[model samples]
Target chain A: MKTYIAKRLLGAIPTLIFISMIVFVVIQLPPGDIVTSPLDRMQSQGVELSSEAIQNLRAQYNLDQPLPLQYLSWITNFVTGDMGYSYLFNRPVNELVGERIGYTLLITLSALLFTWAVAIPAGVYSAVRQYSLGDYALTTVMLVGLATPSFLLALIVMYFGYEWFGISIGGLFSPEYRDAPWSLARAGDFLSHLWIPMVVVGLGGTASTMRILRANLLDELNKPYVITARAKGVKPLKLLVKYPLRIAINPFISTIGFLLPTLISGEAIVSIVLNLPTTGPALVQALINQDMYLAGSFLMLLTILTIVGMLISDLLLAWADPRIRYE
Target chain B: MSELKSQDAIESDNILQVRNLAVEFHTETGRTKALQGVSFDVPRGQVTAIIGESGSGKSVTASAIMRLIQPPGRVTAGSIDFAPSGSEPYDVLALVDKDSRLEQLRGDHISMVFQEPMTALAPVYTVGNQVAEAILCHREVSKKVAWDEAANMLQRVGIDDLQRRMQQYPFEFSGGMRQRVVIAMALVCQPDLLICDEPTTALDVTIQAEILTLIRQLKGELNNSVLFITHDIGVVAQLADHVVVMQGGRVLEAGTVRQVLKQPMHPYSKGLMAAIPGLAPKGQRLATVASVVGATDITTAYPLTRLADGRQISLSPSQLKAFGHE
Candidate 1:
């Protein structure tokens, strides 16, 4: 098992390197470098600059070098934990991401837990009572949850939240705690406003997960093994849970491969719309401004997390099912 | 004929008694009767095989006995009386509303082995866990005791390498080995009555004989009654002491293995016996029930043969003679 995990981690190195190259290339694909917009603003302001001054400006941002040399410098700096600078925020990329990483994880992890807690039981109930009034009711509600656009739902919820509940739904904290240092009241304020984005992002995942689980459980409930378990005098609920549910929940474990990266990346559109301080909004801004270091770092981190998540899910699946484990 | 006893012999000699049992499936199309007034008795300490082709209600009868018919299909009418040893005799149908009681009776006193051994065992759990779960469900033993018992049961069912095999999953084993594991699970609780619903139907011919022999040996050693359901007459002949021949959800003939297989009084039963490929002379075409009975739908073609006059009626002596029962 140790060797297997080591091999998986080793195999991920090449993928991470490949993705790093792609992130660099894609960032460079934009027509203008980060210097273009600032230079354009200066020229529009009617400031006269000689060719020598422009050369110095390009050298300051390391844009005057060969592409490969610039790539090597940026990559070496990135590897050594110096993630270069972000032209968009005009701050070091590390400090910018450091400020937002905690909030990003907090919301995503809680939303994931919420999704599982709600969806798994609802799915089991729906499948066990299939076609009953409760099943139909749950199915309709979850389908609506699945079909509606999340950002739209976030907007609607925000409107109603402010209108009826007198609670401001945007951002994760009140104005008083927005820039405040960590304290009980600030933490409390942060949590009080966290659910809006959590629900908006997690509802869709919960709906799809519930539906998948229902289908998987329904298929397994009729399998001959389930009948064998039932004939063994296992109580209906216990038998359902122990035998088929064990198999049905496998895909849910594998979904962790996607979920782990979201812990860092957050939900891009929802975070932007809600104005949450998360890496997603930061990455989007960096891409728009062509801030290669910040954007490339974000992409690289996401790639690493994805590989780790897939490995974790594979290990978990193997642990849960011996067939996969021994194979 | 000598096995015939009075109705008062219910709890004394028989382990299961089904009376006027009816099951129907209510679907969007219509309600289709799966079992229509089916009645039979499974004598204690012996194998009683229910024989019929597909849709003959052989499996339905087994499910009804275990009260395992799922939704859209329900036992519309039936009284399945179970007289398991060391338990109070009760009508199995009456326990439908009493879930815990029914569950207690199901795996503890009466267990069922299904067809398709390939799918009969849970895939994710280890063989030992599944077999031990069966014991744990009913008995108050610790996990260690249950595991030990499970290992012993596996050994008895002809599975070797107790140490490694117990830790392995169902997918790791062959179909025959998996069937043995399933049998070990069914017998771990030491059930009074074991219902095998075509347990060997999914196995190859050689494996089928091996499984049949294993079941026979286990029944003798364990001293439990078996209600075997199969479509193969050869399987019935090899394992069953008493036989119930069914067609179209109804019983056509039921008696001792010899009485039913040798001198079948009903045209349908005779046709079924004659349909056995091995029973036909070499190079001769195999006769089917439809052809021999001269009816496309034999279920409706013949009324059920009355067992009261079964002693006097004998038809198709040539088929019986071909069967080497003359």
Candidate 2:
């Protein structure tokens, strides 16, 4: 297992390098550079800037270098932990991302837990009691949850949280706890406001997850081995779990590669509506304003997460199923 | 005919007595009777083979006895009285809660070997785990004890390499080996009655003969009754002590294998026996059940046949006299 992980980690180097190049090229694709956008904004603000000043700004930002040279320097600095300066935020990209990544992970992880906790059982139940009343009802509700746009759900949840419950549901913390240092009370406040975006984001995933699991499990429920288990006098629930459910969960584990990127860059629209401080909104803002270093860094982090996620999923699948071997 | 056999004899000699068994399947279109008034006796320490063509309720009878008929298919009517060794006879259909008493009966008193051995064992589990699970499901034994018994059972079923083979999954084994594992699982608990639903049907012809021999050898040593379901008359000739012939969910003829084979009373049974491939000369049109048994009557004459060598022969009057019928 250790050797497999080592091999996978080594293999990810080329993939990460390739993704970094794509991220750079995509960030550079919007017809204007970081210097051009902000300088144009400055000119529109009636600030008098000479051509030499523009040239100096371009040189300072390394925009005057050849594309490959700029990529080499940017990648080298990124590899060495220097994420470059974000002209829009007027701060280093590292510091800008560091402040929000924790909160983003906290929400995403909890929402993921919520998704599996709810989806797996619901999926199993729906499959076991397929065509029953509870199955029909659960399917209807999950379908509605899937169809309703997450941002719209977030707005509705926020409205209800404020109107009915009299709780401020927007953002990660209350007014008092927004800038307060870490404390139990502040943590409690943070949790109190985390559920809005968590549910809004998690519900959609839960719906799809339940459907996939239900379909997979339904296929397995009647397989010969399941009947063999049943004939062995295994209790119904035990038989379901040990035989069919074990096989049914394979697809779920295989999908974990996509979850890592989702963890860092959560539902952007939902985050924007809920006013939560997460990497999703930061990445979106950087992209819109063409903040090259910040946007490029965020995309690179997502790319790395995807690779790491795939590795983790492969390891997990190998662990869960004996048939899956990595040699 | 079963009524003529004294109840006392059946009570003492039979492990399972299925009487007036009826099963129905309710699908979207309408209801279909899968088994109707089907009855048979699996005498103790003997193989009772239910012979029928496909859809003849042979498997349904086995499933009904095991209480394995699921939704849309139900035991609509019947009394399946199973009298396992040293246990009081009880009506299997009378068990109200399918989970409690029925659970104890299955894999404990009565175990089943299904038709498709390739798919019968769970692929995700090791051969030992699946076999041991049968022991553990009934008896409250330590995992080690159950596993050891599983290994022993696997060895008994002709599987070698106790350490390596037990740990291997079903996919690693060939079809014949997997069926052996399945048999080991069913017999691990020393079930009084092993319901084999075409256990050898999915295997190759050579493997099928070996499995049949294994089943008989095990039955003799273990002193357990086997309720074997199959459409193969050849298999019946090899293994069965008593034979029950069925057609369209109803029993047509049932008697000792010698009686059923030598002097089949039912035209359907005659038709079935005549339909055996090798019975007809090579290159001749095989006699199907419909051909021997008239569409609306049982009095159809047995046809004369031209042999592969171009010679023709018919059942002589003396041969018909030996059958004691025209």
In DockQ, how does model 1 score against the reference complex? 0.77
Q: Where's the lowest-lDDT run of ten residues in candidate 1 chain A?
A: A259-268
- State the lDDT at A177 in candidate 1: 87
Model 2 chain A poorest 10 in a row by lDDT: A259-268
lDDT score at residue B108, model 1, on the 0-100 scale: 86
Q: Per-candidate TM vs. native?
A: 0.92, 0.92
Q: Which candidate number maximizes DockQ?
A: 1
lDDT of 2 by residue, A1-327 (tens): 778778878999999988999999999999888777777878899997999998998898888999999999999999999999998899999998899877776777778888899899999999989999999998999999889988889889988888998987888889888899999999888777777777878887888899999999999988999888888898877888899999999878888888656644546778888888888888899999989999999888868767877988988988877777522
Question: Which 10-residue span in candidate 1 chain B carries the lowest summed lDDT?
Answer: B1-10
Residue A114 error, candidate 2, Å = 0.7
Task: Give the CA lDDT, 0 to 100, for residue A304 in model 2.
Answer: 76
Per-model lDDT: 0.82, 0.83
